[model samples]
Target: MSEGTAISDASASRAASSSAPLAERYAEAMIPVFGTPQRVLVRGEGCRVWDDAGRAYLDLLGGIAVNALGHGHPALVDALAKQAPQLAHVSNFFATEPQIELAETLLSLAGAPQGSGVFFANSGTEANEAAFKLARRHGGAERPRILALENSFHGRTMGALALTSKAAYREPFAPLPGGVEFIPSGDTAALEAALAPRDVAAVVAEPIQGEAGVRPLDPAYLRALREATRDTGTLLILDEVQTGIGRTGSWFAHQGVEGVVPDAMTLAKGLGGGFPIGAMIAFGPEVRGLLTAGQHGTTFGGNPLGAAVALAVLGTIREDGLLEHVRTLGESFAARVLALGDPRITEVRGAGLLRGIGLAEPIAPQVAAAALEAGFIVNAPDPSTIRIAPPLVITDQELGSFADALPALLDAAAPAAAGAAAPVDPSAAPAADDKDPS
Candidate 1:
């Protein structure tokens, strides 16, 4: 059959056996925030997944960096299976051992100072919600503003949305919490000016803006924010939701970058390896007492199932030395892709497994579609930026497969859609960096 005929047949077959009825059910039952489903992923394993149609894909996006251990790792599976049969959940009124253990583990990894406290939530958005509330508790009547960076993404919840810098995400939900100001990321002058107001509660930033396509803030800028916030009695909140858990080849992206320490930090995404969990870890004694017993809580936060799964993911990352693995694999993967020397690839930027390939032309969406047809899964954050945050456990062989396929993917995305073309100016007009400040 002809290529066009085959394509039409596949479309018709998909429509005939469609999940559109379920989609219609969702349309009526759910809010139209995310729009139509992209793909109905049925099952996943380490570094790979299949759609409802059973099309195999090399999962390079890692569920947007949430599946740190990939899908269905033995350790995570065992933890969940064992914990579910034993005790799945309990009320927040009663403490659970897994919750406490996970809390201690997160606090320890964060390296918070003594008397630090932690609050658990179910998603990155909720983690930021707790952080926002904690910041407010610290600010009280004196300071109420939060200084965030432009081009930042911090989830869609009301408080987190308020802190996010994008007008498109925040404007639709108007009258959000006030006293928030936006500044250009890495712009020392703007950050200083914004935080200089004694009425500011905190300056929240992601060490590397993940949803904005893995843009890392300069070490010097982070250090400066720490000092600037300190001078004005404001708090420094680092939203490590996407950059944490070995995503940036570090236990935490902020570590070893600069001699800077945030007063509080929020983590999620890769934290649970797939299971949903999020945490807010407050450092030192500054905000420890800010929240009393009756201040805040979550019913499903830190449930035994999630906590147990997270514990296993953390242990596996340590025991398997996934951090060093991510560091090495990331460097090699990046080098190979950059060496592709594709004209459309103007620049490549990332840390560890989370990287973004910037295209000279607006063709990332097409490139991603091409990649899917090629049996790989990748994501396009913008028309010009292809974001890759593969599982930290992705093997070298898998990385090579992607590297081998990349030149073809780029060719398929470029003008002729085949064979290598002459390299374009690497210094071509580049897309502006997407910064996340929450």
Candidate 2:
């Protein structure tokens, strides 16, 4: 039988056996990590996905900002198909052309100066771990503390977890790597005070805080941070895992702001369109060589398959001029949503394709469920925020449909109370899980 036929038969057999029910099958076969599968998504094309029951929904979350080119773009498919059979995995002892090319491409896109380097990893967490090690190496023994913002999120690994500010995520995983401090996100004074002593090895920040309801740090504050860190000799690390790769109308979100560059930047999410790939791009000799040899490694970090896929993703973004497209569409979409003037929608936050709708009450979970039922998929990162990081390929018409549907969705989620607020009980809002769709 052909390879396609064999795969089809395998999928048929698995689906036949799991007729017991989607939830039951998941419960029996998988760990209770993500609570429950939101939907048994079976197929996708462009910005739309289909569930097993044949329901279609507009995918606004874009796999939490990982699907830059959207589901199964021809370029991405061609790249994976051409590269996988030829050279998929080779140990780190040897480097492939695609791997080297990808590294060069990322550095070029980041506009890093000479003597810069990159460390590849499989996820955002690993990339952040590498950055953490670089910070420690640069700081030495005396300046040990690593500083991150109050509403920031790096990743889930031990070192990255230490830098994350959410109590619920960090408290459970206590005794984590020490020497991490949390400062307010947009407070330049607080940052200056924290870095005044020069005891900080690094100051890590997300140009836009994704998990904390898509809060963007003020650009002036970021410039101030650059100045403060420079004066104190502290490294500035930007976590662009969710905001990079043309998602925010630039190669990196920090680039949208003027005259602010980081010592190191962590990128993953959309770097490979949908394939898993992460990288830490360190600028200057001081930050680049800190890792050295044998300090850190990953078996599948920069494999030929991922590298080829990432190169294709980058090429597509550049050739298609998606950066300008995202900026235009994003501004229009945000304006349309805000113009609805729904009482429930308090504010619309974020830039480019990454957006968050802040609600007047804590009914985000209900709003999300209502949206799902209304043939749309969105994320409630917090109890009162709805985040929309749709595929860059999403068209203006598709976004308009969601915008037209927003007011009704909010009404269905919570009927407006003239003087009373929506019920705010513990059970009313579910705790956000590890798979943060930020």
lDDT of 2 by residue, 1-438 (tens): 999999999888878867687767888778897898889887788888777777777889999999999998999999999999999999999999999999999999999999999999999999999999999998999898899999888888899999999998899989999999898878888898999888899999999999999999999999998999999999999999999999999999999999999999999999988899999999988789888899999999999999999999999999999999999999999899889888888998999999999999998888887777777889999999999999999899888888878877776677523333433222222122212132
What is each predicted model's overall lDDT from 0 to 1?
0.83, 0.89
Judge candidate 1 against the unseen true structure and give its global Cα lDDT, from 0 to 1: 0.83
Give a tens-digit lDDT track for model 1, residues 1-438: 999999999888767655566555566557887888766677777777766666667788898999999988999999999999999999988988999999898888878888998888999999999988888998888887888888788889999999898788888899999878888999998887776658888889998887776678888998998899989999899998989888988888898576788988888999999889999888987687877888899999999999999999999999999999999998998888888777767777878998998888887877786776666778888778889998998888877777667767776666534343324222221121211111
Model 2 clash pairs?
Answer: none
In TM-score terms, candidate 1 sits at 0.88
- TM-scores of the candidates are 0.88, 0.91
Candidate 1 colliding pairs:
151-435, 152-436
Quote the lDDT for 203 in model 2. 94
